[model samples]
Every structure is written in structure tokens, then in C-alpha cells.
Target: MDTQADRLAGAATGCPYPFHRPAPLEQPKELADLRAEPVVKVLLPSGDQAWMVTRYADVRALLADPRISRNLNRPGAARISKTNKLFQDPRMDPDPPEHTRIRRLVMKALTATRVERMRPRVQQIADELVADLVRQGPPADLNETLAYPLPIRVVCELLGVPVQDQQRFRVWTSSFKSISGSSEQNRLALDNYMRELIETKRKSPADDLISAMIAARDEDDGRLSEYELHWWSRLLVLVGYETTAVQIGGAIAMMLAHPDQFALVQEDPDLMKSAVEEILRWKLVGSSVTMLRYVTEDVEVGGVTIPAGSSIIPAADSANQDESVFEHPEVFDVTRKDNIHLTFSAGTHFCAGAALGRVELEVVLATLLRELPNLRLTVPVERIRRDEKHLLESFLEIPVTW
Candidate 1:
């Protein structure tokens, strides 16, 4: 097991540290090379060494492993970046029983039936936004026109947040994503804002998610603590706003870039579901690693023994590109069958908003294609600017003409 040649080979390949953690729109080539290896030691931006697991089977196993933990409070847990460490939310970073309880309560408020009920509103929002984009004329930034506003409005309405407060919230969220800002300061400000909103909801409860959670806390024998309530709301707003926005932008970019696939979907409206799934699979908009999970005990993956307390990052991007699991993995096939991409992740922490995000994507894509059949990128694909400091693989401006 102590083969010098193996270690030498790994060292020779050059550890692809950092891998442009904040702004890699395309999957890095080094990740593809690492997928061939059992586990590759990578140096993170925080200067911590972690074992990067890239293969689909191994990544799925890593996410589901009971010994692996998502708890950032644990000593020596691997951190993705200093910003992540500073902006950690208990609702997102906690390991189960706590995670289970919070997730269960949140799920009650975001049930599949509840999310489906919002489809008409989602359609209306999409229609209105498209109408505005049309009124504004061509060479408009879709990121501002449709991508950002759609999810922001949906989440704001769902949480009873005033639509007027969106600009302030955007500033707060942007700081959380920025590499230069004081993450703690931004987090504290956002936290205080959420707490105040919670108080407002408590005084005059409405029919929104925040009101429902407040009722659950006040009437359910303290099932949710004050701290838990605040963090849960923050988590919901962050996920609902950021991830969906990035995804909407990424999906539109991909569809526009791939004219053939775009034509296929436009020709056959029935392929909408498959098309959305393919966009999630093809786009590497999310982080290469879902979130760092620390190894609790010495574990063997691909014949490599990773010691306890070591950081393990499951490469969702690579898993989506795994040749073993997907045919013509590089091709963006809207009609690809047997799609089981791990973009929303898997296991205990699988994204709770998956259904809602799917609905937004489907509605936006369908509406855009139907309403603006001539929609095309205003700039070359290479000219589209990326937010180099933003955590998500996001576009600064997705200018489009219809």
C-alpha cells in the first residue's frame, strides 16, 4: 500500500489547487484527470489539504457516508474559503438530528404541493419580466431583466419580504459572495435584518413561509428555537435567491450557446423537462464541491485510506461528467435519458428547494422560447463577463437580443 511510485505520480501531475473556486464556468481539465485517480490531495484556497473525490460512485458514497460530517463547528473541519467559514449558518452547516429537525420543519413549509401551487404566480412573474425585457428593447442584460428579478420576487413574496427591500438584500448577499468584503460584518447585518423581519411577522403573521415558521415556533412547544428560526430564514432566502438566479442565467446561456440543442427543444415543446435536467447536468455553475465534509474515521475510498479529520470534497461537476454513468457525457443533449446528475446533490443534505428551482427553470425556459423565438446572445460566448470574486460560477451580465 506504500508504493513510492504512486505518490510520485500524484505529485508529478501538479495539484490543481484553487481551480478558480469563484469563477470557473467550464469544468477544469485537471478535475477530469483527477477522476481517474482514486483520491487526489488538493490544496484549497484556505491552504488546507483535502482529498478530492471525483468519480460518480465515490462522490455519491462520500455524500451518503454516516462518518462524514457537514458540521463546521467541529475542530479541524475543512473549510472551502475564509468567506464560507465566516458566513456559516447553522441551518446549512449542521449535521443531523439538528439538521433533520430543522429540515423537517422547513420542508413542511415548502412541501411539493405548496411549491406546485405557486406555478401560476411563477408563470405570471415570468410573463411580466419577459414583457419588460421586450419593452426595454434588444441588447438587454438578461441577468438583470429575467434571471435576478424572477427568483428574487418569488422568494420575497413567499417570505413576505417587501419587494422594495430587494436592493438592500442584494447588497448584503453580494458581500457574502465577495472575496474582498468583511464576511462577518455582512453576515451580521443580514442576520439583524432577518431578525427584524421575524419580529414583524410575529406581530402580524401573514400567509407566507416566514409567518408559518413563526407560528410553528410559538405554538409548537418551542420545536424551533429563536436562533434556529433566524438561521432557517436566512438559509431559505440565500438558497432561494442565489442558487436559482445563477441556475437561470446558466441555463439560458447554455441553451443559447448550443444552437442545435436549442433548436431541438424549440421544435418539440414536450422536451422541456428533459431540457431543464440537461441544463443542470451540463452547467458547472455551482461549486465544484458541494460543501466540505470532514472524515470522522479513517476510511477507504478507491483503496486510499483517508485519515480521520481530513477534509473530503465530493466533486459534483466531475460526477455529472462521469463517462461511466453518462453516454457522450460532454454533449449537451436535451433528450438525454437516464439522467441522474448530482447537481442538487444527494443524501441527507440534498437541496430542499430542488422542486421549486426546477419549476422556475422550466417556466423561464418555456416562456422565453415561446415569447421570444428570436432570442440570441448579444455578445460572443467568450465575451460574457464572469464574476471572478463571486462564489458561484455566475455571469456579471448576460446581454441578449430578441
Candidate 2:
């Protein structure tokens, strides 16, 4: 078996194909070039060779293949960084019966019907945030004013987290997402906090997702273990807000950057449905791959054989931009029909909160456009700063004036 370093040395002689995950708004040229290859060998931050599957068909196939497992604890699993190994979620890593059991327990709280029931509340939260932004006058940071707060408030309410404690949770969660030195430390702190919250829910259950999970029983009349409860709660609270927040920010930034499309949606509210879908398609919120899936057996993908235990990353960004699947893939057309983007990922690991995230985006975008029809960026697009440390790509601050 060739080591990742040996494979890299033997395969390509030139400088390792530079795989810089693009910034939030920037198109990833390196990924586009990688898509042309049968299978691109790229070095991870961990200095391990992982296959980057960039084509739409290949990524989809890779995701659906049972031979590829998301469990990072497996030997030879591809990791993004050393710190990432410290923060694995059981809900995300397990395969089959175990994963199925965990997903079923959690899905009871996040079903489409339950999420749709929260739509009015989501809209109310969005309206309030937009109203506050308007009251604050022009030159407001939408990222802070709307993007961050709306999702945070909604998720907290749904999870029974005290809205007053949001600021503290925000700080801890920010550190959890950071690529900085303190990320692990913050992750541990968040874990401890969630543990305490779980205990609280156990003793005094409320009508929230956490409490619902606390009382939920399986078909066999089994309850979630303490460990399962802790990790799932943490995953719910962190991902519940983090991903949706980024999408909201990305959608707004993309729309404001392209005023023509923005005006089109603003003129007719009915287009909001397509606009939301296109925004999800066009935006690159998450990483090139959500998590590294290790091959459990020899698997052929994209005309290349991935050996057992080798790590492979499915490039969702490249898949979204695949020419075969999307026409004029570069253009952010709101009217795209049959738009199928991998932003929320695909297959069994597809985001459980996707439906909720969509509703949140729809409400927020429609509310913002209606309330602030004249919204425009205060600074040049190039001047916008992005958080380089976090795994997800998004503007740190989006100052806009209406």
C-alpha cells in the first residue's frame, strides 16, 4: 500500500495542485481545473493525499456509494486539520443501522411538517430583525443585524435555549467554527455547556427540540444514551444556526452584488421560491467537501480506483458548477429550472435541517427586500472582508445602506 506522500511523489512531479478553498464570493478556478481530471490528488491540511471528486456525476456517485464511510476515527481517514479530529459528531460519522437509528430519533423534531409549522414564527423573527435594521438607519451591517440574529433566535427558541444566553452561545459557537488556535478549546467549552443544558432538559423538560428528544423513544422502547443525547444536542445547536446563518449572508451578498437579479425578485414576490433555490445553488457556503469519507473497500469512482481505507472528498462546489448539469453554470440565474445543488450535501448524510434552512432563507430574503427595497452595498465588493479561519466561507461584515 502506497502512503499518501509516496502516491503524491509518484503521481505528479510539479508543485502539488494548489487546492485553496475559494473565498465566499470568489469562483474556485483550481476546483474547475480539478474537475477536468479523472481524479485529482490533493494534499489536505493534514498533509495526507485524498482524492478530490469534482464532477457532478462522480460526486453524486461517491456520496451514494456504501463503500465510502464518514467515520473519521477509521484508520487512514482524510481529515481537514488536526483540530477537526477532536470534534467529530456521532450523528454525522456513523453508517447504516447506527446512523439510521440516530437520524430517526432526531428527524422526529425536524420533519418537514414541523418545520413548516415554524414558518410563521420564522417570518416573525425575520420581520423583527429587518425592522430593527431599518430603525438603526443606513450603513448597517446586515451580517450582524439580520444574518446572525435571525437564525440564532429561531433556532434557540426551537431548541429551548434561553434567548438571553444567545450572546454567550454565539461566542462559543464562533470559536467552535474558527480555524484559529482556540477552536478546540472553544469546542470543549461548548460541549460542557451543552452537557449542562442536556441535564437541565432531562430534569425539567420543555416543549423544545431538546426536550422532545429527551422524551423520545425508539420502536424498541429504548431511549437515547447520555452520550448520544450530548453529541446530538451539540450538533443540533451548533449546526442549527451556523449553516443557515452563512447561507442567509451569502444569499444577501450575492443578491446585492447583482442588482439586476435582486430587482427582478423584488418586482414580483412569487419569484422568491426560485430565487431561494438559485441562491442555494449559486452560493458556496460550506467547504468543497462537508467531511472526508474513507473508503471501506476498493471502489472505482470517476474512472479511478480508490483503495480501501483511502480518504476521498466529494467537491460539492465543483459539482454545483458542473457544465453538464447546469447551463451557464457561472451565471447566478434565479430562474434556473431543475436546480440540484449539493450545498446541503447528498445521500443519507444530507442535512436534516435543510428544509428549515430553506424556510428561514425564504422568509428573511422576502422580508428584507420588502422592507428595504433600496438596499445597496456601502463599500465596494472587493473591500468586503471574509473570515479566513472558519471552515465555511462567508463575509464577516456586509455593510449595506438603504
Candidate 3:
């Protein structure tokens, strides 16, 4: 298969800097070496250069820094992808006051209270998925049967989007987030689909998040613009399902690989909360680095002076494994205390759907542990393949049997 890595003419190597991982479950090899320097220049897949921060304190500090902006459309901002302008899109990264306003409306729409109320339904969904997987017998792809389907269904129901449209949603979202595909086309398709859904909800509303967001917009009158509503809806649908879905497969893989840690959770289900946190910390989605943030003014990161307009990648995955913050940072300890991973990020841009994502993951893991106690991977860890078509380092299939 001709991947982006293969096609890029002058893509740099050796630094192996950005998204290069030694194996499916391994962290990027350069992470430890990069941490020694703390901050260093690395070339991206797009053939653009940016500074990446690996230490926990530095990553957390960068995430919370007000001077660092998510709006990467600036003239001097480093391009994340040659084809995928998803990062560079203005609608995707709005300015402060507008960003603040959209976040406020989103909070009003997808409140923690509302997410908590869906706990029962979420659990039921997990139960049904497990039951179905069992009924279908063994040698099944766990990702297809469980991990991939669960979150999409949950998000679709939450947003009042049709669960029937899940297949199309999956394709659109995969393309939308793919580092290898035409990001602009996929993004437009997603945006158009979302706009149509919003219009449909406008005509005939339902008791769902989208409907609620629409109501919030109408009641406030320009507090949330039409474009903001559409953009937020599209983004929510994408992240709401994609990241959690990828995390489920990765988390399950991590647990199965370390039965001792899995045993801890099995022995005491109360450990599930911390276990989930550990999974979040340990899980590597794709690139350790997340969305690039352009500095608003001169900033000092890890003793290095970064001038205004320089792009920086705050590596939360690398931070989660920092030796300074986490003891035995290499080990996957389920009982590890104060497991403050930056998977959901920090500060103003913290994930809005985090609570809901947590609920889904907890339910999926707990239910699987209880119902499929003997579940084991049918293939060796290294034999498993990655879904390289998408940006996230997720499995193509997790073949498992009980």
C-alpha cells in the first residue's frame, strides 16, 4: 500500500520525529531521546518543520498557556498536512471570543448532567455489543464487533443524528481525520452532511444534543452563529466517536498484553476508574504530538526561546510517560495514583465530550471484563496490523476469541 510516508518526496528520517512508531503498541522511538533535549526541531509528514515538547511539565504548561493559540491559519504557521487543511481550516479553529462563545453554548448543550443521565443506556449498549459478539462466536474482530461501533452509536444517539447513517459517518470521519487522504474533500463532505442534519433538526426538532444546541442558538440570538453551530456539530460528531473508538481498541490491547494489570482490575472492579486513567495515559493514538499551536508572542519552552508565530506540538502521550511526573513511567500500572494524563488536553481547549467518553470506556471495559473473562487475542501482538489509512494509530482489526 502506498502510504503518505512512502509518497512524500523529501520526508526526513532518522529524527523519526513526528508519527514514527517502532510497532503498533510502541511509543515513538525518538520520544526518550527528544525528552533529553526537552525541545527540538522535527520535520512533519507535510515536510514542514515545528518544535515538539515531550516533558510532562512542559506539555501541560504549553496546553494551558494563553499565548499559544489553536488557530493555525496564520501566515507563518507550519502546515500539518499537504492535502488535509483540516488543521488550517478557519471554521475548525476560531478566535478567542468566538471560541469562548461556542464553548459556552456547547457546555449548555452537552452538559455533564446530560451525559451522566445516559449512563444506563451506555451500559445497555455495551451489554448488547458483548452479547452479540459472543453470539457470533470467536475469531472475530473485536474492533469491528465492539470498539468501533459502540461510541459511534452513543454519539449518534446523543446528537440526535441517525444511527442508521453510521456507515457513512464512519467513512466520512475516517477520511476527515486521515493523514493520508484528501482532508479538504472529506471535511467538506462531513460539513455538508452536518449542515443538512442541522437543517433537518431545525424543521423538526428532537430531544438531543444537536436540537438542544440549535435551541440554545435560537434563544440567545447570535450568541452562537450559524457557522459556529455547524462547525461545532461536525467537530463533536468526529471527536465524539473517533478518539474514544480508537482508545477502546488500544486500551483493550494494553490490558490483554499485561494480564497482571488486567488481573488487578478483574479482582477489584473499583479499580476501573484509575485503570481507565492509566489506559488514557498509556495509550498512543497515532502521533504523540497533537494539533499544532502557533505562539502568539515570544515564549520560553524548556529553556529554548520560541519567537511569536512559531508552531509547537505539545506531546501529551510523551508527557504521560515522563519519568519526572510518573514513577516507572515505562510500566503500565493500573493502580498508579494521581494519573493525570493529558490525553484530553488541559485548559481552555480541554475536550468537551470527555465525561461522556469516560462513561463509554468504563462501561465497555467493565462489561467486557465481567462477561468475557477468558477473552484473548487470537493473534500475536506484533502480528496485529494498524489502520494506516487514518491519522490515528488504531488497529485494522483486533482478532480475539474466548
Clashes per prediction? 0, 0, 1
Writing each residue's lDDT as its tens digit, candidate 2 over 24-69 gives 4767566555566646677765566777777889888888889888
Instruction: Return the candidate ranking by lDDT, descending.
Output: 3, 1, 2
Ranking 1 against 2 by lDDT, winner: 1
Please state the error at residue 313 of candidate 1 in Å.
0.3
Q: How do all models score by TM-score? A: 0.92, 0.92, 0.92
Measured with C-alpha atoms, the lDDT of residue 90 in candidate 1 is: 47
Which has the greatest lDDT? 3
- What root-mean-square deviation over C-alphas does model 1 reach? 3.0
The whole-model C-alpha lDDT of candidate 2 against the native structure comes to 0.77
Compared with the true structure, all predictions reach lDDT values of 0.79, 0.77, 0.80
The digit string of per-residue lDDT tens for model 3 on 1-402 reads: 533323331234324346566777777655665677666666766777777787899889988788889988789787766767765666555557667777887889898889999999999999999999989898788899999899999998998888678677787788776666555666678788889999999899998998898888535535567887887787788788888888888888888888898898999999999999988887557775455788899999868898897888898877888999999988888999999888888888888988998898899999999999988888788777887656676778888888
Q: lDDT (0-100) at residue 25 of candidate 2?
A: 72
Candidate 1, pairs of clashing residues: none
Q: By the lDDT metric, which is better: model 2 or model 3?
A: 3
In terms of lDDT, the poorest run of 10 residues in model 2 is 13-22
Clashing pairs in 2: none
